[model samples]
Structure formats: C-alpha cells, structure tokens
Target: MADERLIAALDFHTMEDVQKLVAELGDSVSYYKVGMELFYSVGAPVVTWLRQQGKDVFLDLKLHDIPNTAAGGICSLMRLGATMLNVHASGGYTMMKTAVDRMHAEADKMGIKCPKLIAVTVLTSINQEDWEGLGQAIQIKSAVVRYAKLAKKAGLDGVVASAQEAALIREACGDDFLIVTPGIRPAGSDTNDQSRVVTPAEALSNGASHLVVGRPIYAADNPVLAAENIIKEMENVK
Candidate 1:
C-alpha cells in the first residue's frame, strides 16, 4: 500500500538515479518532491515521468521573483501536472496572490485541474543561529508563523514549513491549510543538513499534513524498508 502523506524527496541529479529509487521504493511512497536540483538536471519530463508512475508530485522550485515573472513561471509550470507547487512567502502578498490568480486562470483556460499552490515559510535547514546570523530580528518560529499566515491571506493552499512549527501554523491557519513538512528523520536517523528535523510520528502529531523525507529513506542501505518503516511510523501517529 502507498502512503500519500509520505513525500519522498528525489534529491538525485540524474534520471537513472530517480528511476532506480522510485522503482525500489515502489508503493511505499505515493508522493514525491522534485526539487530544484532534480528539476534543473532532468527538467519537466521528470514530473511527467512521476505522473506516469501514478505518483503525486510536489514541484519544489520555491519560485521567488517579481510579481509578473513569478506568475508567468507558475503558469508555465502548471502544465507539468504536479499535484502541488510553491512560491516563497517572502515574495509578499501581491506576488503570491498574483501567482495564485494567474495559476487558477491558466488552469481554467487549459481545462485542467489546477495544482494546489503553496508557499515556503522558511527553509527547514535554518535554525536559530543561522537565522540570527542573517540579521533577522524576529525569532524563527514567529517568522514561520507570520509567513504561514501571510500565505493563507494571499490565497495560497498552504505552506512548506518545518514540523516544529506545524502546531503553530495549524493553530493560526486552521486545520484545512496544508503544512507540507520537510526535514523528517526517522528515530535515530542522521539529521544531515536539516537543522529542525523531526520524527515521522512527531511531525504528523504536530499537525503536519505531509512529510518530505530524503536521506532517511533514499540514503538508507535498503530504501524500500526505510520508507516502509517511516510509513509505519506515520500510520502509528495518534
């Protein structure tokens, strides 16, 4: 069986690596995040391939540009058929709203189902020290919450945030707003570059709608088993 909430992050740079991993993971993962590295390497066809395999995609380009440029990018990417896509919440309200409106309008014109647009609140890899180093006055958790609220107000479907802030975002944005949490490490797994990592069960219990897992699954000796174990952990959340 596949777990839709468990989004495997395809961080590989080659199509061969992606194909091999997806084949190995099989039904344990029903969703995937095709981030900038993979997308830049393999291009839109990777998204097409994922859809062909009956898997949902979160196209993680994290578009951040001027209003018109970002909206144009969204309109273009929407044709790739990803289940979800996102912009940077820091792109501000008008940019986010313009992207959302244009995306919906483009989908309507094309007669295709619009991808659920989201916003990146803050990278999960940024911790307190890193945040403070950037000369940011507000705390990381507070900033994440503010971004989540701004995203919702801008008409986005939700946000890409750390599971650590899931409970807060849920409280502020309500139950329906999607909080796609990355930096998910299973118990005893290495955190790697993710600074705000959480266990699968903890993320779900903290109100994360989806969990994007990378190293714990893909970097494991047996990727399929790792993914299944994480899925089991997610299923056990209560």
Candidate 2:
C-alpha cells in the first residue's frame, strides 16, 4: 500500500496525543517514528504499545557516542523490537561500525531481527549557512553526499536526510542504500520549523525510500483525510 512509504512521525509530547493519532490513523500508515520528545517522556512502553497495535516502530533516538557506548545503546534499542533506528553519521566510522556489529551480535543472541541502521546525515532544520558557520567548507548538498558515502562505507543500511538531498545521496550511495527523508509537507501545508522540505511525490520521486510526516498530518483538522491526501500524492508519482 502507499501507506508503506509514509512513516507518520509521532512527535507528540504526551501519550494521550499518541494514542489519539494511532486510533485515528491506524493501518493508514504502518510505520511510526518515536522521536526524542515522546521517547524521553514515555520510554520503551510506548514502543511496546505501538507494536501491540500492529504498527512497525522506528526508535529514532539518533544514538551518538564513543564506540563502545554507542554499540551498547544500539544493542539495547534493537532488543526493544524497533523496525528502524538511526545514528549520527558525524559520529565517525568506528562508532557507526561498532554499533552495527554489536546490534547484529545481540540480535543473533536473542534470535531477533535487527532494525535498519540509518545514519543521520544532517538535520533538515539546518541550512547551507548553518553548515558554513559550523566550519563545513562544502555546501549542504555536498556535505550530505559525503556523509552518506561515509555511512555506506561503514556498512549502514541507509541514511536520514532531507528530501532535497535524496537524489544526490542516491547518486553518491547507489540504489541499494535506503534514504529516509523527513521534512515532508504536502502542497499548501505549512513548513513550520523545517527548513528543507518537499512534497510526498517530490520526495519519493527523488529516491527517498520513506518519508516522515508529522505536524502536517497530526496537526490537521482531520488527520485521516490529511494522511489519505498524502498517500494519494505519493501514489500519483510515476
């Protein structure tokens, strides 16, 4: 279904909002991303609850730390039964590889499937000027491509990047690597705080394997209809 391409971002601050969204949009979108705010407030129980409702959960803590510590964190999160997870590409190759290796080992020990290890290339909230200020010499698109290449070299499944960079990332990393794009807004929807944004069709056509949509759907007058409209937009491509 087109819903497979739409991973509704559960960026709520409380469990009540999460529950309402789940109940309202159940089965319309199979994948749900439990980002920092919700995760910090509710913890693993939320992941368990989402799974119980038959939804695939993406535990997006964006783990980044020393090699050993990051590895341990990934192992722990994998045991939570997440379908996808992320680590910062800027964390360096050793940290990413260590996390990937440890995740595989732990999953094997528990006889469980490991989630796709996606690297966070850059936050969509940032712009080219932001990168330049941070001492990054290249433009935003070039930096994203460089990071995606590094992640692939470190054996990551894919990367989390802005939809605007999806095509560049795919060109640099090839078709096999996954590109999970966030900052997606439907036509006429407010961009909010997201600086790098694209429509559902634009993202998918640009080679994004999945799109994380939050406020555009959740904050809408009718979330179900909003989600349905997005699915229609995605399906209209190609």
Best by lDDT: 1
Per-residue lDDT tens digits for candidate 2, residues 1-238, read 4377789999888999999999998678888999999999999999999988888988899998999999999888888888999999999999999999889888888888878998999999998888789998888998889999999998999999998999999899898999999999998988899999999999999999999999998998999999999999888875
Q: Write one digit per residue (lDDT tens) for candidate 1, span 1-238.
A: 7888989999999999999999998888889999999999999999999999999999999999999999999999999999999999999999999999999999999999999999998898898998999999999999999999999998999999999999999999999999999999888888888899989999999999999998888889999988888888888884
Off by over 4 Å in 1: none
RMSD to the hidden true structure, all candidates: 0.8, 1.0
lDDT of 2 at 132: 85
Global Cα lDDT for candidate 2: 0.91
Candidate 2, residue 6: Cα displacement in angstroms equals 0.5
Score residue 53 of candidate 1 by CA lDDT: 98
Q: Note the residue pairs that clash in candidate 2.
A: none
Candidate 1 clashes between residue pairs 3 or more apart in a chain or in different chains: none
lDDT of 1: 0.94
Question: 168, model 1: CA deviation in Å?
Answer: 0.5
